[model samples]
Target: MHPRAGQTKKRTRIQAKNEAKILEAALDIFATFGFRGTTIDQIAQKAEMSKPNLLYYFRRKEDIYISVLERTLDEWLTPLTELDPDGDPIEEIGKYTSLKLKMSQNDPTASRLFANEILHGAPMIEHVLKGSLKNLVDEKAAVIHHWVKAGKLTKVDPYHLIFMIWATTQHYADFKIQMRAILGDDVDQPDYYEKAGQTISTVFFEGIKPR
Candidate 1:
């Protein structure tokens, strides 16, 4: 049987630190190479540890991949989970869009990692997407629909709107190379992201304003 997580009794601080190092290294390798392209050897090298030592914490590459995906999904969805229904709908959504844009700028690797998984049909995380992600989106969509009914937002499909926000925000990270090449050094300017967030929020909320 596969070893259960935390099966080992009372891990020490050094073990915890080493485990974190291994997982962080795994994220970089997996994001760069994708799961099929990455290997335990590469992860071990990235972590600056021997393969045998790395295997002590995670016996297989699959375990490390799953752990990274779980953590990434938790972080990626935090802004969405924090959206407040009690706030002004436009402001709430604008803040969410801004937060996503900031994440795209600050954590492009994580964004691309998630995108890569989705591009490959999410073999490693389809269950989480279909279950936890879907449930969360459904709950938020209800809130959006309520806003629409109350004349706060225009009558638009909330799910599609959510998808649009995700795609637009994530584009900055997944396509940063293309963006940088096209825009030159201007892409590196902080104002570029601020303008992007402002533009995206303006266009979206304005387009969906009650008519």
Candidate 2:
């Protein structure tokens, strides 16, 4: 089960602190090595705790990985899930694009970890992808469809639009090496994410604006 919010039950401050440390370390390790490549020993070491102590909080590697993934997905989906059906469609899309780009800049590793899972066929997160993620996407897709039908947006495939946004926004984080190689020093500049957001928003909204 996911250890999100209330699901984890009550814990003392010390327990919470240790759990947070473990998850943070696990995220770094798992993001770098992925599921198969990562070992419990590595996570324990990164967390600066004994293996048995770490095991006291999380029993298995899979458990830790799933918990990390669940938290990551929940964080990643916040902006998407917040897309308001009542707001201006174009502006909403722009906001979502901006938020996603910011996330790429702020938390690249989580994006890479999620990408790594998908690249490996998403064996670990297949259920959430098919169930909760799909459901949320479908819900938003329908909203987009309504906007198009109402002449708020140009006719476009709602699902593919969302996919394009995901692909374009995440490229900065997932392919930072290639981006850095190509853009050189510019990629490290403070305005990189803002510029990326503008570029992606242009690509997505330019054609889709009601003509």
Candidate 3:
């Protein structure tokens, strides 16, 4: 989905690697400086490539920015997409919660990048938010509804439940500085996220488990 079109041929290993490198550098730049503050030259420098070489893969800064956001969105949604309706509702939700927290712990940059995009009105990725994201969330919400009706969960708004999970899990990434300030550097430790997942699951399941 990167490299200016027109080739109509499969990318070589080198081409694929170069594109990945560009996206990786662009993510760091965009996440730190944001879209407006970031520039093609900055990404090229970050990638340790000449500007011309970088442009060979991505013609415009906007192209690189959109690609990064698209990739991040796919990754950010993967945990929810994995939720299985056929599984035990509480267990499934707990697994989803843990996976989401793991993502924040492992790749907080991606989470912050995405959160910043939304804060600015998601000007670049609104279509995706409306289409693919909406469809996926709706499908999962229906699954949650099914669980509730089947007496697996207490009556609750599926959309809000999903939103609550997102808010709570993502807080570790979006407000990491605040977290680190209050909780200290231990916030970066694996056990911290594990404990967070356990605490969140306990609180959520306690409220939602069929009473």
The model with the greatest lDDT is 2
Q: After superposition, how far is residue 43 of candidate 1 from its true place, in Å?
A: 1.4
How well is each residue in 117-145 modelled by candidate 2, as lDDT tens digits?
Answer: 99999999999999999999999999999
For each candidate in the order shown, give its overall lDDT on alpha carbons: 0.89, 0.90, 0.89
lDDT of 1 by residue, 1-211 (tens): 3233557667777778888998899888898889999999999998999998888788788989999999888998889998898999988988898899999999988998998899999999999988989999999999999999999988899999899999999999999889989999888889999889878977886654666
**What is the per-residue lDDT of model 3 for residues 1-211, given as tens digits with 9 covering 90 to 100?**
6545757878879899999999999998898778888989999998989999998898888889999998888888888999999999988998898888888888888988988888889999899899999999999999999999998998999999999989998898889899899999898788988888878887887754566
- How many pairs collide in each candidate, listed in order? 0, 0, 0
TM-score pick, better of 1 and 2: 1
When 1 and 3 are scored with TM-score, the better candidate is 1
In lDDT terms, how accurate is model 1?
Answer: 0.89
lDDT of 1 at 133: 90
Q: Which residue pairs in candidate 3 have backbone atoms (N, alpha carbon, C) closer than 3 angstroms, thus clashing?
A: none
Alpha-carbon runs more than 4 Å astray in model 2? 1-10, 207-211
Q: Candidate 2: how large is its RMSD?
A: 3.8
